[model samples]
Target: MKNNTHHKTIRSFVTIFVIFSSLLLFSAQQTHATPIDPQYIFVRKDGSSCNPSDCSQFWSFNNPDKINQAAIDDVLNKIGTRGNNNNTRKIGIGVLIHYNRHNLNNILASIDKLLPLATENQIPLFIVLDGFQYLNKAPELWNWWDQDQPGYDLKNRSNVEWTCSNGSSCATKTAWRNWASEISLAFPHPNLASPTFIQANKNKLNTMLPKISSWYQSLPQDKKWLLGGISLGLEVNIGGNYYHYSNGINPNAPNPGPGNSQSDQLGYAAIQFLGLEGGITSANLDKVVQNYYTELNKYAYQLGIPRQKIFDHVNSPGFTLPNHIITTPESSLSPYGNPAWSFYNGDAANPQQFDTLHTIFQQQGYIEWGAAEWRAPNTTYSSWYQAFQNNFNFGNTRFINISNWERIRSEPEILKAIKTIANEEPTCWVTKPQINITTDKKSVSFKINPGNNNQKTRLHISSSSEYRENGLLQNIDIVNVPLNPNSTYSKPNLSDGQYYWNIVTTGCTNQRRITAGTFKIASQSLPGDLNGDGSVNIFDYNILVAGFGTKYDIFDYNNLITNYGQ
Candidate 1:
């Protein structure tokens, strides 16, 4: 009896030992795994001395003296080095240049000086080459809005319009192509000797319009690398009060059909210019109107404008992709193909819009896009930080540009804001969360190992891949689960389709706490699977046929073509 009891006790000890060893192994794997990719944030410094109040008039092009060296030095002195002053290590500096002035010499000279500083600091520079402006008030383009020019119209039409006085005469397409071609030629290999190119185009040079290509061609190779990426135009969308002007004036205004009050020459011009007729049906009128921008995108590519080079800028809201645009040269896909966002706004009213933007870009297979230009909302450091934080704290955005270095040099708060973003440490995860979907596709189970004993696991679930809605985070469902080494949380009644799960440990003492578990759901439904039955069958076909020739008709057809009978 004594021997049997001793043997039983030994067995009990072995069982406990096995369980404890398993737990420790699991903990070790959770704590030490591959890290998430680093996030990059940048503070943009404008290379020009343009007026802070108005971006339209009294512009000087590329004055090396006007490059704001003091501001550059100040920003560099503080935040140029990663992890400097205990700030985030991934932040870099960005320099913006509108080198499309009458003489590219000024911007070129400015860039030459700035590039070495950027190189010495190991930073990336962003270059913006302005495209055609319709009624550009610059003194050089005397014929821009002139009434007697070939494209001009009277009846206050010419006075009230943007871009071309009439639809047919706008040089936007030519100007876009020219800017790209000019920049590529101007920045040819070996050296930045653009004087000869300038001399060759001297007869044709528009003294008022910028010499962007000439300026680029003039820069040395070392100087060119500072221009990591070139964004064409400040804001590429058609400008003016076209949306508000229903009374025959704004060139970019919507056409309210043939007999509406705002319907007239300008409306007809827009309709014709956008190619909206074939897709137009009574029910799909709104869709056709929305597709007008898509048509603008199509027309832009048709003009041989390099989507690869142009980071399409959106100064206002409502210019984002409605669905997706399938364009050519695969390299020119959305986000990258039609990359756009706002420079003036602090945050999107709809957080889901950011997710949708990421989804659209990802669908086109782009790994990253850029945050639009950043400017301090108010004079305070807190306000600037909030503005910059709200805008840059989105997914898959790799680059950011500030309005001017002058602000960095002069505003103590702006530099502080830059430091704050630069020093931000990503939340670390003990282990990647494991996500499981039940067979019925109605429930999702998430399991994450807690990072710290004091930390609570924060869980967020979303139908969206990016956990956002209408460009905001209003739609994401957040729940805090108790800290457990292997905690399981199951959410039932989830609709069929793709879902995303993000798990991060909270309440940690470390300021550099990282977020570990980010995962997507297991299933993907076909695009044409309208009934959510997991397959595109006869039912989906019927739905597509019924909705044919309507707003989403094109998308349906695309779905059918891609996933027919699947």
Candidate 2:
């Protein structure tokens, strides 16, 4: 009996030991496993506030500068900004809508991205919204009508008729103006809720035109007004006004079309959240921004905003991918006869349009990315370079979506169009102003018409450190002088040896900076004997060692190592 009891006890101990060992192994694996990828952390996000009306969901930014910097830095390099941009210019943006509690968070996000561009462009944005919750939650964001008191009288000071200008059916305009007043009357001050009606959306918009003109009239004459907003606001701001404008989630809301973008519906949901009484989640806000960009080229063009402006938002090289631009040439499939086309999308309507847009996009030095399958809003391409002529035409001009076209294999003979354009830009790149870089340190020489000598010559040279990252040349050395026809750079100081210099030439009267390909300053010639100090010393031996040995540096490395020999 004692032996049997002892055997039972031993068995139970063994079983317990086995279970403990397995648990230990599992825990070890869990602790030592690979870390997860770092996802973007949007400060304003919290899982619970995914809905729009909750202001808590909205990303909080008390300082407008960070938002402004993100925006200005994104656009200035592409769309171009004018003189002396400390980024503190007042820009007016008119959005006509009152975001209910559900969409208020999204409303704030939309304006956040829009404000920097306005500020950078020197335009102050004046938003027209039927108020939900205002003040502290969204700083730098305001609703005139939502404020009550002076909202009505602010518009009348101008000479324009109450709702119509020069007598026309201004039903749309008048209706919105009336709505703003009604929404204002209901929500005179913040509380649990204000009344809801379709008229409120309409009324918030019509309030824009008259009030905007007055605000525009109020600004210092030099300032410009920019209009931004999504959906209902888009309708009133751009659709209703006939104002030449640029914005996202375009083509007016409720686009009843055969090709309804299911993807675009995300924007509607985002708007609904942002337009809510309080606010929406930050993730939702980001999605709204992304969706707007996703529909960009097609919708913007459809809305008649210029292509360059539409492309500007995508100019942020560091903004990550959707962003499928081929960042590294090694990632390119040049080894096979099927290199990915250096463009984005599936709309292949106009082959030339696809081709031209890519050309223009890349010319600005942006790396391009696209979906594996073209997800463009319009156009198509059948094969490489062979475009379907007139297959897609807007009025007289043709437009194509490269996304629909066949991929271009990087071949020796078919030299890609992008490469051709890249090499062709006359060294001087222009965004808002002109800038030229002389990569070579050797002396560069040139005249207005290289072959013709009659033009007055002016050369502006700046040290590399003098140029800002945006390529703006500051503190440059300017030399203005006339030369006889064919007078090679009146000064030959920029030689092959002493070529650590940058030279920019302009026609004295044209005010145009002439672009000479980046040239180098020639290495300063060593005068003395045939070699170092005219002597066959250790210096010469060191020079020989640097050039002949595998350990020697490529250029200056050997020269420096041998310059002063033992």
Write model 2 residue lDDT over 409-480, tens digit each, in one string: 212222232222212322221111122221222334443323111133345554332222112233454334
lDDT of 1 by residue, 419-488 (tens): 7766765342122223222222355565554433225555655554321211222245543444355656
Q: What shift in Å separates residue 333 of candidate 2 from its native position after superposition?
A: 27
In model 1, which regions exceed 4 Å deviation? 1-40, 46-60, 78-93, 99-101, 108-113, 133-228, 239-310, 316-338, 343-362, 376-393, 427-566
The local lDDT score (0 to 100) that residue 128 gets in candidate 2 is 27
Off by over 4 Å in 2: 1-459, 465-475, 479-485, 491-566
